[model samples]
Target: MNKPVNRHPFPGTPKRVGRVGAGRGFSAANSNTRISLPGRTLDVSAFAAPASHARPGNLGLNSDRLRAQMIQRLRNQGIQDERVLDAMMAVPRHVFVDEGLASRAYEDAALPIGQGQTISQPWVVARMISAMCENRVPVKVLEVGAGCGYQAAVLAQFVKEVHAVERIRGLYELARGHLRELKLQGRVRLSFGDGMLGLPNTAPFDAIVVAAAGIKIPQALLDQLAVGGRLIAPEGGAAQRLILIERTGPAAWHREELESVRFVPLRAGTQS
Candidate 1:
C-alpha cells in the first residue's frame, strides 16, 4: 500500500454522499510501503510502485488512528455491530480505490473509480454487512456488483468465503487486482458476468449482498439463498429501500425493509 504524501487533507465534513438515484434527491459524490500483506502486487509494469517506500512508522499508525475514528463515527451513526466495525477497521479501504483518490478513501463519502461507477458510502457498506451478519458469520457469501471489491473485501473479513460478481469488464478486472493486491483473493473471488443472474453453480450461499438497486429482487438470487440465509439489497424504482430477505424454510421467506437508499441500477450481461 502507498501513502499519499502530498495529497490534500481529508475534508472535515464530507460534502457529498455516495451514488444517488437519478430522480431521487440526494447529495452526489494501509499495507506497508512496498510491503505486501495479503497478496502479490499487481503487475508492477501496469501500475508504478509508490515513489517513496521509506515512510515513517507514524504513517501506519496514522491510518490505524483514522480507521478507529471511522469506527467511532459509524457507532455514533447507528452501526451497532461490533463485528462489522472490526472488519471495517481491518480492511484498508484505500487499497480498493485509485491511487489519486486514496486520500478520500477513509471519508464516509463515496468516490468515483472510473467507468462512471462509485464505491458505496462507508456507512452504507457497514450497515449492509452488519445486517447480513447479524445472526452469525456466514460460511459462504455472494456479493453482486463488486465495484472495485471494497464491499466484498469487508464481507470477506467476517465470512468464510465471498464470491463477488461484476458485469463490467473494467470493474471486474480492477476488483480482481485490488483483491489480489490486498492478499484477500483467497477469501474473495471476483467474476465477470451478469450479476442479475446469481451464480447458480455455487447456489445456496449463506448470505447474498447486492450493491446496486433493481426494480425488484431477482428471482435467481432468491432461489440461491440457502435455507436460513439472508439476502440484502436496495430494491424499488423512483424510491429505493434497503431490503433484507431471510429464507426461513424450503418454501418460505421473511422480508423486511431497512432504510431508504440510492444506488446505481443493477444491469444484466457483461461489458468489455
Candidate 2:
C-alpha cells in the first residue's frame, strides 16, 4: 500500500469526533497510488483506476517508512486483532482518500471526502470488525456504510463475500472505482440506495457492520441477518458506544455492549 509522509511540524488535538452522515451525491478527486511493503510495491488498482493517472511512485503511493508509520498509528490506537491488523496493514489506504491527502492515509483520524461525508479512522474500522467477528474469522459480511470503500476492503479480507451498501451514488461509484483498482471487484459488491432498507436479496449475513451510527438498530437489518449473525455498531449521539447484536432463536436476539464509539447518525429515506 502507499505510505503517507507524516509532517507533524505543529500538532493540534482533533477538533471533533463522529462521522458525517451519508447525505446526497458528492464528487471526490481521486489521486490514488499503489501501496508497498518495505521495498516491494503492491498494485492496488481495482475498478476505480483512472487511465489519466500518473505512476504511483510519482504519485507518492509506496514507501517502507510510510507503511510502518501507518501500522504504528493503528497499533497505538489499540487495533490488536492480528488478522485485522494484518489486513489493515496489507490494504492500501491512500487509494481510498483524496489524492491531495493520500500522504496522510494512515493517520488515526477521519478525513473529509466531500458530500458531507468522511472516510472512517483505521482504528475505528478495525474495532467494529473485531467486535462483530467475536475472535473468529468471518465468512459472509454486510457493511452498511461503503464510504470510499475503505472499511469494506477491510472486511473483504476475512469474509468470503462483502455486500456493502452506500446511500449516495457518487460515493458508491468512487468506492467502486477504488475497489476495482485494488482487484477487489470479485470480493466486494457495492449497492447504492437506502442502507437502512438493507439488502434483502442477500440477507442472512454472517456478520453485519453499520459504519454509520443510528438512534436504534434498523429493523430491516436485523431481519436480514442469519441466525447467529453478529451486528456491531455505535448506537447513540453525544455519547456513542458500540453495541453487538446477536441472533439467538428465530425472532430471538441478544445485545451486548462492546465499546464506546462515535459515528454519523444513520438516516432514513433515499438520496436522489
Candidate 3:
C-alpha cells in the first residue's frame, strides 16, 4: 500500500468557493476531477426549477415526498433517531446526484456516481447516522466513502466535525463542491484517500461510519475510534449486515448487529 493523500484544507477560501458560488457547480477546479466511481459529472443547478413547495433545488424529486419516503423506509429498516431523521430530511437529496438521475434520487437503491462507487441511498445514509448515537452525545465523527459527500453533509448537523475519506478523485472534488454548495464544507473536511485505512489525524472519532461495506470491519478503524465511540458499518460480502461496534476499553470493543445491509464494497488504495 502507498502513503495516503492527506485531507487538505478546502482548495481556497470563500474567496474561491469552487464551482458552486461561481455557478459552474462542482466542475474540476485545477483539472477535471477523477473520481473512481462508475459515473459521470453530475449536472447540478441545471434541472428544471422545482415547484413552489420545494423551491430551493429543482432536482426533480418532490422534497416532501422524498423526505417522507426516506423516513418511512428508515423506520421499516429500524432507523430511529429523530435528530438523524431531521438532518436527513433537511438536506436536499436531489441536489446530490446528476440532474438526469434526480427523479430517482429518493429511491432506495444506491446509484452510480462515476468511477466504480455509488452514493449510498438516503435511507442507508440516515440509517448509518441514526445508528451512531441513540441519544444526543454530539461528538466528532469519522466518515468513510465520502461518495458524493451527501452522507458527510448529513452527519454534520448532529456531530461536531466530520472527517471523511474518499478514494476517488472526481467524486472527491465533486463532494467538496457539494459541501460548499450547502455551506457544509466548513463543517466537513474531505480526504482524498482510501476508506480502508481511515483518517488517523482526526482519530478517536466519537462516531465512525463506513459508508462502503467490506468483508469485515477494517481493524485500523477499530484502533482509531475513541473509547465509547460507536462505529457503524455494513460488514460481510454476499450476506452483509449492519454491525455496531462500541469501544469499551483502551483496546476492548463491543459489537452488536443492527440489520441486514447491502452497500458498495470498501475498496483499497488512493489516487497516484
Model number with the top TM-score: 1
**Per-candidate RMSD, Å:** 12.0, 10.1, 14.6
Least well predicted 10-residue stretch by lDDT in candidate 2: 44-53
TM-score of candidate 1 relative to the true fold: 0.77
Q: Judge candidate 2 against the unseen true structure and give its global Cα lDDT, from 0 to 1.
A: 0.63
- Model 3 quality (TM-score): 0.72
What's the TM-score of every candidate structure? 0.77, 0.75, 0.72
Q: What is the lDDT of residue 38 in candidate 3?
A: 23
The digit string of per-residue lDDT tens for model 3 on 1-272 reads 11111111113211111110111101011111111112332111100111112223464446778778877776655556677777787887777766666677777656554444455555546655666765546478887767577878887876788898876676677777788888998899888876777777778788887654566677888877888788877666676556777787786777776544444455567653
TM-score, cand. 2 vs. native: 0.75
State each model's CA lDDT, in order.
0.65, 0.63, 0.61
User: Better model by lDDT, 1 or 3?
Assistant: 1
What lDDT does model 3 reach? 0.61
- Higher lDDT: candidate 1 or 2? 1
For 7-92, candidate 2 gives per-residue lDDT tens digits of 11113312223322223311112221122223333222111211212224323545455666777776665555667776777787
Kindly report which residue stretches of model 2 are placed more than 4 angstroms away from their true locations once superposed.
1-64
Ten consecutive residues with minimal summed lDDT in candidate 3?
18-27
Instruction: Report lDDT (Cα) of residue 171, candidate 2.
Output: 68
Sorted by lDDT, highest first, which candidate order results? 1, 2, 3
